[model samples]
Target: MTTGGIARQVVLRAAATAAGPALLLRRWTTADADALVEAYRDPVLRAWTRLGVPDAGAAVRWVEAQRTGWEGGGRLSFAVVEEEPGGGRVAGNVVLKRPEPAGPAGEVGYWTAAHARGRGVAPRALQVLTDWVFETFAGQGLEYLELMHQVDNTASCRVAEKAGYGFERVLPAVPPFPRDGHLHLRWATGGPVPG
Candidate 1:
């Protein structure tokens, strides 16, 4: 519930892809458990992230973890929702995680639901999240943002570049991730940040 006033400052911006629904970035809620689990059902998502949400109970825990992270002021995550007539549907998730509160940099992660892929959901949400991070944490000493994805994940590579996280270097293969990965970095103000 203590999300750096993010809950009160939701709706960072409204964006629409010429042919897609408007997008809104907000904090995760327990009510989103079902949707979260449903999105994770996609094999591609499960394969890449290795995060398996087998049921609503697991999804609730995942959401609760985000709340805990917020309260602890560590990882700030947003639920990317696409607006429709009846209501808003979750399109993706974006998160900015800082292991050290006053660290010079933080890491970012994101995923677009199967239904929302190819609709520009990942890049749009990531851009909003990156801007928010710089605006909200620059004064706290956060100077840069980093994004990493396996080299084989072309979709993620595109998302990283589209969001302006320029390639920094290659990361070593680690456990759970047998493949080498690419590290993309963006400075607080002077980097390849998109407009």
Candidate 2:
């Protein structure tokens, strides 16, 4: 999808992790439907995630939505996959969304499947996504990325920190969910990013 004046595809090599399988960040596909269904079966995932892709059919719609978003120049969604001997397993998802393409900023959001939790999947995938965004959109006016999570979600806090996004501020309660939220940010630098 086109964001902040740049357009590029998401491709990734295996990202090394502390434990478990290597991670790969790539565009979402309909083939990921079954995995999406299984991942959503986790109560934690269902409660935390905004999109409710509870079944294969719904997951297909979710993938189609991403494709539509990409074609319409809005959000870019990636499937976070873990590499194993037989093949890659869908571990979770990460998305970069820009409400205003003319703006110089965007928001990042992620979730890790139950099996992928505690294995550094979210942070590793987010780090790669952040790097790709800055590198691919360097001269296209993309300057900053932001992430928000419920203050009580300590795991998400850790993910933000591990991904090198500085905690910006704690936003007050907002709506039905995500009360006591914290805002995190990462600015583009010409050199290597920390995490």
Candidate 3:
């Protein structure tokens, strides 16, 4: 299928405004179940996401949970589709999760589909999402965007670099992984100017 066809099937129209040429950043939808299954079932995706292999039922539940997060507020998950000649296929996913009580800092996370790897999709999606966060929620104190990648995931680090986020530092005690854990990298954007 063409990328446009995949986009029409995978991308939510409401979130289309947040899209760019190389990628589409859209809100999660219940209807995304099928595409979610197709994308998430890839072994590479499972590795990067750390979400484990999902059955069809599990995939449905996962997409539903993402939608729930939107309704609940303070979290925004976007489906990233690569724009090909005839539109684009669902390349992967990205997220801008607002931190509680931290004020204006958003944590960013992303994963690219196996087929779309090495094609510059993730960084492009990140740039669009970052721009959208600044424009849509800057008034609400959106200041910095932070990302953490498994040090072993060199490709992800490259994407962060391409998107203009500097290497911050490696921190220990990171949760969901290990105490002696993943390296943390942070980038500040759209925050109040210092005195």
The candidate that achieves the highest lDDT relative to the unseen native structure: 1
Candidate 2 Cα errors over 4 Å, as ranges: 1-9, 190-195
TM-score of candidate 2 versus the correct structure, residues matched by position: 0.89
**Compared with the true structure, what per-residue lDDT tens digits does model 2 show for residues 167-186?**
99999987766578999999
lDDT of 2 at 97: 91
RMSD of each: 3.2, 3.8, 7.1
Ranking by lDDT: 1, 2, 3
52-133 per-residue lDDT for model 1 (tens digits): 8889999999999988888777788889999888998998899989878878889999998999999888988899888888
Error of 2 at 33 (Å): 0.7
lDDT of each: 0.86, 0.83, 0.66
Top candidate on TM-score is: 1
Q: What TM-scores do the predictions have? A: 0.92, 0.89, 0.77
Candidate 1: what lDDT?
Answer: 0.86
> Between candidates 2 and 3, which one is better according to lDDT?
2
Give a tens-digit lDDT track for model 3, residues 1-195: 322111222343212324434566676665666777778778777776768536667767777767665655556678876555876677778887764624857788888877777767787788777666666665666567788877777887889888777777766655776533244344344233676
The better candidate by lDDT, 1 or 2, is: 1
